[model samples]
Target: MNSLQKGNGSVVRRVKLATIHLLALGVLSGVVVSLHAGEAISPRRLIEVVDISGPVVSPDSSQVAFRTEQASVARNTYDSVWYVQNTDGKTPPRRVGEGGVPLRSSAGLSLPAFAVWSPDGRWIYYRALMDGKVGVWRASADGSSAKPLTNDPADVRNFLLSADGKTLNYSVGATRDEVIAAEQSEYERGIHVDSSVPIGQGDLFRSGNVEGRLATQRLDVLGDGFARVPLLSGVPDRWKAIDLLTGKTRDLEASEVPSPQTIASALPKGESKPWRYALDTVNHRVALLTRVGDQGDLVQKPGVELSVLLGKNSPRHIECQAEPCVNKAISGVQWKPGSEEVVYTVSDPAEGMAQSIFRWNVKSGEVRLVARSAGLLNGGQRYGLEDPGCGLSSTALVCVAADANRPPRVEKIDLETGKRQVLFDPNASLAADISADMPVKLLRWKDAKGRLFTGQFFAARRTGDRPPPLFIAYYLCPGFLRSGYGGEWPLATFAEHGISALCINYGPFSFDAVERYNQGLSAVKSAVDLLASSGEIDRTRVGMGELSFGTEITMWTAFNSDLLAATSITGALLSRSMYLHGSLKGKEFISRAHKVWQLGSPDETPEQWKRIGLEFNLDKIRSPVLMQVPEQEYVWLLDSAVPLMLDHKADLYVFPQAPHFKFQPRQLLAANERNVDWFRFWLQDYEDPDPEKKSQYAVWREMKAHASNRGENPAGSRGD
Candidate 1:
């Protein structure tokens, strides 16, 4: 959901908060509340209302702290600190600090997320854009005395505090240093596509034609002491590292001189992009996750020599090269605490169902199962992806688990015994009160290309023989899966009204694989054909709901199929033309491959985009369309969606203060309750009042109030 503003500027949408029952959490203390798997959960009362973002965890796993914002239409965002005991039924969750006012340091435009407790358990370290760059800031774990950790001008990506808690090892780099350096050196190298910046600042003097290498440092815990590591030197496509402490220089890994034919042959095919290749490091062994081919490789250090980890496999022998394998699934790989055991996540898009945690011993290279998740446990849950959350101190593994019918709950599992403990149960009480409808059914159909396609269908449990009015959800994204759990409003809320929802899983979309591109678009037609044959769905009453890339699929489906009665879009694309000035992180592999991108690149594939970019083909979208654009999206979709709405006369509105990533707390609550109300009006002809529209968003209200007294946005406006 990258939304581009008018200029080159871009902003990531903050995370959203969903309601959690306070009474339920209070009752959760001291009680081992249990329910059969897949039981429907009806939240009694929101126990702890915390901003639902980031890895909200406590050091000891006893308590969890998170950012919760109170939403008001008149304001943009209202942020506050919230903490609650992580157990069953005992005490009511309480807000920390002065009443509802945010801890002074936490005030800002973005939602409060990425709340991480320091290793010492006394302070929390998070990012605050103070003093020109987003630097690390420390706050009392109880929400007090929050201040900047350093005034250095560096953008912090991730940080790690040393064992003694005095030294912090964090990775920070110049925001556009690489791009700027490359652009500066472009003419000298005559456009070497592989131009990069490496370490070694002491040797500012350059070899002929090579630019002075940009300085990258691996900071030591000691204040004012640092060392430099060069990712790329002036040398074309070379990696070298310089040890600042010892002043010794070394080559990181030598480059392979592939033949020109090999390079050219590796180009993308059709709408498919080449796979991103990387040397996967596991202890002493290394493997490559490559897009060019399926043959996997294992490499060792020093020589940077590669050996095949897996070879070509037959169709039936549990082939491991593609997914649910070591190369593709593992990320943030690390050794287990006090042991040589390595841990990683085997995430597979096809499995889309869940991510299984796997552990490999560094000493023996022996792999074992650690914890399996029903879906991605990391933030990937939103993108329908998953990764492992190793302990900050290397003792425990943190995981998130959920499925089609379950809201996720955070859990920590011990690597040694395989024992698990629940940290945050999102639906503990709801599970006790109501029975969830039957588990969603999975289906597989063969495509014209002889490939088997998989999808999920969830029907209302209400008894009746009448054909259910099926709602098809369109999906597109490299990080998410069609089967992954979406928000409660469209799926669960709609189910409560007796409408069946069918989620069409399309691939070779970004969510399935980056290299695959829009390969899955071909399958949507077949999926619709199958649904049309199903007697249980009323084809005339079908509806479509799309978010992000799903918006593309929904538009395609609606343009082609007369079955759909209406379409709802959020954080979606308005047109391919919008991508011209679109703000995508171009360093990513997909963006780098111009030829592959052009295959689906909205600009080059204008004809194709015109057919699918609902904005241009509105006449084809006879069904009333509801288009929503998040105010905080990476790209100003308003440029596209709003204009298209005006052109097609579609019903369109902006969800103020909401980000591309998540909704405001109040917005989420209202969305879950009232959004479905709007759908029911169109589907069941059920009457509901006009949804309340707030003049000011929750975030803006907070900002204006703070401005009234402080004379500026809490984060400081541009003019300030």
Candidate 2:
């Protein structure tokens, strides 16, 4: 028999007879059955879920090419694969090729660069690793053959296909300063210490300059490099055009290709380009989703407007029938085939942030709704639709759709009737393996200041008569429930472990940094009180998790209130060390910090430091904190962690070679499992029986005893 203790100090026993009976049945039948069946999602299984991107329609609009990425634990990285499927759902999606270099933007989001097809739709061209070289490779549409198209010394960052399909335009270059640093390191010359070098990068012998060799020598490293050389910004890329028929390459001028600024300049005055725009060459009109603000301002209001410019006439604004068009942005703007109608997607705040698709006739100035769903449409982990999220055919729009309960799947939506048909589901088997009908409720609440907030409430599976403990993760809750923004807290897994989880989406923020943090704190407090009042959760047993901007809010809550029983944060908090390290990046970083936080040098603004720095507020924090940070960001936490470690109030673990967003398979699994264990021990007084976790539980046990000695009750208790 096994025993578990509830928060009320009641013991529940698990009998072994049921398990024995199942085992005997399996033995008599000569088959093995799982003892733990229909449990909530596990961290290992969640990591195996496939990430789908790029349902790019073929030129003939008959087939679509997409990419799927899944974590490979043995390889410690993601395995990228490509697939092609018919738009009409007539045939199943077939695998075309594997592996590609993903294109990452400055904002750190990975763009779909693996499914670019030729004009004839006979072959797919993408950048991949070939013979230890990063180059362009092509595969037949039928998956019968594949070959390398370019064997360049430098990796091709991005490529474009011409209309005629005779030439391929590609760009390959490195940051100017990093290239110079690589050449200098080759000669054993001492590097010049300047503001360009970010602090805590490395020592002189093995500095960031040496790491630049990865970009200069091999050029196979995915995403952005670790070096923060400020001089790298604004440097133009080297462009080249390759003739497919003649097998020749020649340098092309920068002006040969249109830039974003150049394209935006062609728009009408007082109208600026948003993330996605629609250009109708046949109708001689352009449609843009523009925000309500000046051209170059950093901060803009949430309200947005649709602007249409036809043949240089005054820009006409189209208004939606759904009033109060207050939104951060809209996306997926595409021109209807051979018509003056434009289609786009927006999240209606009045409808619990439900995503809605709308179409507007530029010639008639009329707008009409196409479809509306509380779940996301043409959206993924993030809130809005990504670039090239949906491709429009003559009669239907093929998009990637998902929600809190659904993993991303390719769907074909009829343009006329708005009926949806699933074209492909990559994670159908994985979803079936971890089958459990976890209930999800969309919760709406308002803070004391009248700011409205929305959250997804996941109820505990087996709480009995007692209200379950609640765990909260912030600040964005979109699509799937794998984790919040940073993928730190496992929401569904928490529910399976008898703890209800709340994932809160942020509302509007104030301009003042202090007020912004207070707003977040208010929202969290309101959520807890709302749940407690409704008998949905126990107010005394509450925990929180966060990353990035959410970390700032978590720290503020810990400093100002006694709400959290336990807390976990990934990445660094705001401290004097972080400010100093950021200052080393450049004046631009310093200027932005001053603009946002009003932060300066510690010596210059000691008062402000005491007001906002986590190091200064360490004396007030009462909850035990778990810090699982990336290796690159661990140094910034030293000032705060060292002091907290002395008091046994915090434990820190660093993942080696990890970025702000952990993508490595083993690292992600380790972080997710550790978080689960940490909360289970603190919030539930429970531990897994696996012997591998013996030492982990031992350390936590000591920490619990230390808390008791300090006259503090264990977490999930009735009183402090």
Candidate 3:
């Protein structure tokens, strides 16, 4: 049975946190602890926090629709729920449909895939996965009922609704004849070996015994050397439309479908060219938003230029009179109702990464501030009313916003007064508990290269006179500090257990891969110096955790400097073996790798390979390393991990059927708990009391003994 009550003119649905603890502990065994007032966040609690996204306003601006996703350990996957709330804050949000759409790309789940509201504001339509098939679905806004609009066999990748609400157009993947033939061949015979399929893709096919052999076979038969076809390539997406009046569906001709970018025209030529633009049909003018710097330069000064083009007249640049006018970037550009004004959002990195909404009068050329946020607006990377995570209306702006401590929540801002009202908070209780235990402080520092960088420092409560060990997670630290980008390391949990942590954002990168790695090394060293000088942490006991690009930097730091006591990476390293493995993907991938890494065949570029390759620098690394990666990436680690394992300096664990970013609840919990244990053992010389980890501690103890025999210290000491 469930219980609900009324709060603030809305129904508040509450669940017992103890139930979550029990469920998590029962599934993952020793991964979660009981939650209580003032208790610190655990690995399971962080995974269970609701991730809210796709906030879209109704056609009449009377209500907003959004989705929430949370990890379900029992199901071993994520569950998404959609809800509808009145924009006026007068009524509580209601659960609309059974679930929201599941939109995934090659990389994995893409969030903020908005649901389209019906013209009459009575029904909201979205794409969802049912019985392993993706199709369009709709639910009554009043939460009375829900049903599917399209039941196509092929997965619908995208869709659009006509203004009149009488028609809906959708696009789905169409299998090619070659693909079908290849699949049939694989079914009858084993997979055929070839260079056309990437090693990762081929391994996936072989592991699942599924149908990915066609693209590779096609390439092989055609002898299309240097030309690469994706592992799942087929004909272009086919479009279909449904007529609501007659309840009929039909294929759409190419000419009947408009281009995806019909709203914006060609970009103008200039140093500050706009990355995004919009057209005003009513006034016959255009609005462009540009960032003032080289598009590829990461450390350029923060500045933006908003210009308007009226007829054939010269472009007019709108002047911003507001203080702190330096803008890092601009997004969400659009013409207001009646084309009287243009509205856009600007993010100021200098002001704690604050975002503000501004309106520019086309006729008078006056810029006025509508609303501002000390944290993020709309979402982290993109900011726009048209964005799936935000919506705009004549009288208000609704978006998903959050800061370093708070989780994302739906907030409605009054357009006129700039007043903000919280419409819904999905993680209120969890956020409160975490915030109380671990407080964040914004940190800014410049590396030796004079490049500016920012970070979030989560301070731990000191339990003794000696400083606590510091843990560093690198790459991007935007919005909430939810264990960095991949959520691989539990930052709050670390701080609660007496390990201070810092999440550093990478600065401008160099085209030269070696120099870029050096930059990351400098940034990490600078951060350690800053915290140590302030008596906030013990720099000698510093540990690091990373994913993707951060893993590269961690390796470089380990080889180039002895600043790290222990390191954990959730990715594979780049090496000679990896280059050969990547060649299986095709010529284009190999070409891109050459350009990015400036590496060729080892026979041709021995010096280049020896300079940055992991295999060549393993002898220089003194810190112990932990490798936890997806099964797809596990093979790439063999070159380095095999050597390190023999030397008792590394450990590797792989998650089956996992993507680059692990999404399974059990896998995520295991990774998180393993990371926590690894850092504690190396940095603090502490071990968990759980008896299940007895064998795990035994292996580490042996590694520690081996390190001592080699005249090395696994744990940091006062004197080297």
Candidate 4:
């Protein structure tokens, strides 16, 4: 008989006569089977994936408390709700906090984002905006007795309960008022004044000939562009340690908190963005992905470091890039279930290099190889902002797991032996519910430059005779279902409509403008050629789309190739100036992307700007395009969009003021919905059922008539 370890450390075994239990379950409807995957995804079932986020298993492992958010048409915003379910998944998750007053954040973000169960399992503590700012709130396990647990003046970004269940630690960002006051105080004290002048803006004017600067040598920047932005102060997340029972907070002001700015700039050896820490009190240890300053050269920069902390002991530095170590950034880490061992993931940058998982034993101080090409396929985010709660259970780890042939799946990995068990199947169930898996296969190829590229493809089924229309949805999709709430392309939804989706991941390009553009664009062209050569997807009906970096690539591809029949983009600035002048993050991204390809900075290499800049290449675009950008980002878009729109070759869609990564669910859903409509009309000639889309179709049909008269067809002419 098979044996299993229960959460309470009791051993359970299957009876000799297992057939009787199966017969009983078959006869009784009340006896439920867990993981009853319902149906394949379609436009109708898009809501199914929306509510499956932040599944937190209770401390006892008997139940799970997860957060769910849905786009509400009636309310014109997304609504956040919590759900409780048995760990076995036998029972359908039931919504909690019901009939209580609904809560929404002032920023239109859903409330109660991350939910964690109290040690006693009698309460669930979650982050929710109370009176315009986020604070911790607790609700009874049954969703009643909802009350505030902490009253912080600012939004709490992250919080966690200590292993002993006595210390509650959290982090919060500085508020606008705090930042302004600090700036004013500094100015009054004869410190540097904040200025609105753009970085390198003065250098160009200081030199009589701007062209001379680009042609001859690098312009000396007066100061770092982003570091000058007072609001962009590179402060670490401010932490607060609170006594759970007394509600007494011990803040930075009371403690000897290290100066984040000084620590960040002078990090000894660590070189990533900022240090992030996780505490495991049971082992009296803390783990941090951080950097330290070099004593010889304060300005010398380096990569990040992985270190461990023991009680009153200096952090035990784990050499991740030395002999007997991997030369890559530590991707993720998790404490072994009921143990002091830390499991982590890391990857190399070379082509065909797979992400690997490792286990570091704190007591033994030995890092053991765990799994190679590990669970990278699951849980995607362009920026790893929110933690997806990838952790361990009593005996196994429930996380996103993947392999070469299969996409990511919710899997349970044995913590000790590393054997895997599939807990949820979003693919095969779709095959059972619909017609076939529209089986997905890994697509591997090389660019003209011989740079290796890889992605995924959905095999076409159920469509008769006609080659499947192809749509390329991109931006570093590594695994199966994604974790974030916004900006995700509707891949499965496209597959359900009988259109095959090619999720392309390109070469990790450096910042050189030409190489970045060429290597990435060539990879995409190669993927398309492979698909077309297979005679599985129609070449003429090809379409492409992206948000953020993908949008920039789409523009470059449209300019470089006439292969795409249609495209959608989010980056719609009139010149490279906006990209160079926008958010610090965007500016750094542009600079790094260009530099990687041997391209110089804009101030030093104006020629490269003229080549890869999207605004300069609009005339070269043969495919019709759709421009969907946020209102805050429309400053330079007018000059760009009017020219494209005036040609009747593009459409400009303006959304409410929202950051690149932050979009209201309603807006995100609407964008995806409209994208589907645009592709359907242009690539498949399938008019949408919604009447609101009729005018759009009419315009598309008129464009079609013009194209037909000119002897062009996105889809091959039926006459052919």
Ten-residue stretch with the least lDDT total in model 4: 1-10
TM-score per candidate = 0.58, 0.86, 0.86, 0.69
What lDDT score belongs to each candidate, Candidate 1 first? 0.42, 0.65, 0.68, 0.53
Q: How far is each candidate from the true structure, as Cα RMSD in Å? A: 14.9, 9.7, 8.3, 12.4
| Model 4 C-alpha lDDT per residue in residues 1-720, reported as the tens digit of each score | 000000000000110100000001222222222223444454323423332245566788766665544444334444455556555656454445421222322111222235777788777777665455556777776645677666776556667766566777877666645654654564466443123332322221121111011110111122222111123233457788788788798885646443322323333345444455555645555556664434232222234566665543443444444332443556566666577677776644342224666677766667776555522522321123334445456654555454323333344455568666554433333334433444556667876767677676666554677788888865555444221122445666677676778776655434345665676688778888887888888888888887655776777888898878888876443255454453334444455334333334566666766687666676787788887775434554665677777767778777754423334446666677777787777767787678877887777777666667656666623421
Candidate 3, residues 61-121, lDDT tens digits: the string is 8999887666766667566667788999877688777553344322222334568899999
Candidate 1 residue runs with Cα over 4 Å from true position:
2-23, 27-163, 167-332, 379-381, 384-395, 431-445, 476-489, 510-534, 571-616, 631-649, 656-662, 666-675, 689-720
Ranking by lDDT: 3, 2, 4, 1
On the 0 to 100 scale, the lDDT of residue 589 in model 4 is 41
Instruction: Determine which window of 10 residues in candidate 1 has minimal summed lDDT.
Output: 219-228
The Cα error of candidate 4 at residue 680, in Å, is 2.7
Model 1 error, position 245 (Å)? 26
lDDT, candidate 2, residue 627?
A: 92
